[model samples]
Target: MLALLSLPDVALAQQKARTVDDLAKMYDVASCKQCHAKVYEEWEKSTHARSLIGTGRTIGGFQGMIRAGLMGAFTKSGVKDVGDVKVEHLAQCFKCHLPQISDATDEVARELVKAYLDADRATLGKVNVNCLVCHNTKAILHKWQDGEPEKGVVYGSKDGPHPDKYPAMKNSVVMKEAAMCGQCHGTGPNFEFPQPSQCATAYGSYLHAYIPAGGTETCQDCHMKKDGKGHLMPAYRDPDMAKRAVDVDVEARGYKFLLKAGDSIPTAVVTVKITNKAGHRIPDG
Candidate 1:
């Protein structure tokens, strides 16, 4: 499934994070679990919760991209060895995998790629899209218009004082819209890096085909708000959504076939057709 934050266009920040632990200090979801336990538990089951170590495939892909794209001489990324890798080198994959990497030093990038290459799940899984990623860091779409996301503020549907570390809560303008998910759900190749790479095009498909075809549901409508999905935000991984997104039909005919020996042989022809009923492409990759 494409990450809900597959298009986290996090602005570069002054480097502070040097290790996964450092990042956890700012983005850990566990901290919010105290008050938002239900939502936090649901998020724990989501792909966003394990944005970097998703099913172990994310780690393998990161390892492969480093080997083939950075060191393979194909992209000329100026990274010929593992030690040569920097945050900039991993920008293509980290754009979606973990945009918070932008807040870390190059050393963190080197450590991450090495962890991926070494298949270190514990290390790779340490940092991920946490509560702040949505409710704080990425909550506002128009930063200039809405002002920057305040440090102690947790953006949600309505404004109020939070009970936890986040002292304040402000209503987010784009929280219910598709843009919140579509922002990281991918539009096209990430052209911001020297070596551009695309993770998912569902958002582009949603904008072009789904919207033009008069499809009214937003991504949040189907993924977040529907069927009590909440923070789970399932896609194809949810069996019900999979069944609803695709349909298959089968037909078969039995007939007699002519043989060269002037004898008739029984023959069977089977035809199968599959259709997509979802807003975006099925099995988006």
Candidate 2:
């Protein structure tokens, strides 16, 4: 016998379509499109889009791994006859390469490959660094689910969509901080691998050079702003940003050359320290 399930059935049937906000609440970046149209547009053109899409880089890295027998070692029956070992490592590759979908690890790689084949070859190359790579970021930690806001991210437009329902756009501190960049830029246990895993040293350079020196510069300050950084996040992508980051700051003072020290001229102490002030527990590789 079937009892009447009126209100509960109606309620269940009437569930509304999930908004980007709803998706964001569940850590799905598919929702970021609600307000980040400009940044997304730029990212679509840049290599940022290819962060997850299949690339020779992935093949090359994996092939190198295969040659090293990392995949072959953990197989069930035989070495050459090995099954896919640590396919999870592909996900790790996407942690930075396809950050938006990284949180949606449930089905990122297949979706990426599908998306890539559907689009132009040129489009596929620029997939990893996507639209919200830097702007929507609160911090640059490895885990998508755990980025902390070093400061709150502020927005310029009043009507722009945000996690907060209000239209006010002040106290958006997250956008101007170094920690936001450190999520992906820093080194740690997760990155201490034989292969290049962490960008911590790069992030460290930015922090120490700019933050401690009383330079109100963030990663974006030098790489993005100094030369029209634009949304592409060209610091790592474009040669221009690399050249721009390279600059000579001449701070000259007369050396005392103290003989009384009785040391090897103190080794010409040129102390340079880089910081990853951005907060995120990077993997302990």
Candidate 3:
């Protein structure tokens, strides 16, 4: 047996968080506010911050996914109810919503499901896609090329010695790439699971439709750079961001015309044109 002291940092770090509280402590976001006050404030208002507890919709979605899908006859997931849920079962939804759930135990998965099912806001709010999630856990898209995310190292735009809990900070090769956001923003259908899910497909449209149609801007170029909202990463939900994403033109005209050199005829014409100026398809998940 491998002694605890001799275990590799990755294995030791992810010794399997025992509960929702334990997972929350593993990737605590509150501590980051000390060093990143402004960015943290922006993130506080983002969908990522409220991933599992968003306007009652996200939690409601999970309740349905669990009751109607995971526990339903269609999936054959080998579960009769939420009580039987495990980490693999929740991965369908939590893969992006609360990715840190992966490090947690099956009991934690069951607990989270019940919490969401009952709309227990306090407990559901315990975890989110926070600093450690983006700048660390999910920073590297290709583990083979960039190596697995280190336990204590934080990935960012610059390489240096971070001041607080995270002792190291290294620049990630894909941090600024659209693929970074694509990791969660997703392509069509996540085939990683047995029953495929079509949760998010914005990245797919961005590549196939937006880029193919002479669009050059990237996801970050617009969301983080042009919008300049930083961690907020506003999308269709924000009125201003939604308005700016598309351009609409309406034209109406009424006129009278002589029909076959006989009686005068009245005519009306109207035209509506909508141009999608954003980097991807409008109304994409």
Candidate number achieving the greatest lDDT relative to the actual structure: 3
Give lDDT per model, in order. Answer: 0.81, 0.44, 0.85
TM-score of the candidate numbered 2?
0.48
Q: After aligning candidate 3 to the native by TM-score, how far in Å is the CA of 7 from where it should be?
A: 12
- Candidate 1 lDDT, 1-285, residue by residue in tens: 864423333323333687778887767657788877899999888888888888646677777787877889555677888788888887777766787786787888988888888988888778887788888888998977988888889998999988877789899989888888777887888888776776688988999999999999988888877788888988887887888788989999999998877799999999999999888987783
- Candidate 3: regions farther than 4 A off: 1-14, 252-271
lDDT of 2 by residue, 93-198 (tens): 5455545443433233333333333543443343345433454443333435534533334343232445743223433344566665566655333543334343
Q: Positional deviation of 196 in candidate 1, in angstroms?
A: 1.3
Q: Candidate 3 lDDT, tens digit per residue, 173-242?
A: 8888888989888888989898787878899899888888888888888887766898888888887788
Q: What is the TM-score of each candidate against the true structure?
A: 0.89, 0.48, 0.87
Better of 2 and 3 by lDDT: 3
Best by TM-score: 1
Error of 1 at 171 (Å): 1.1
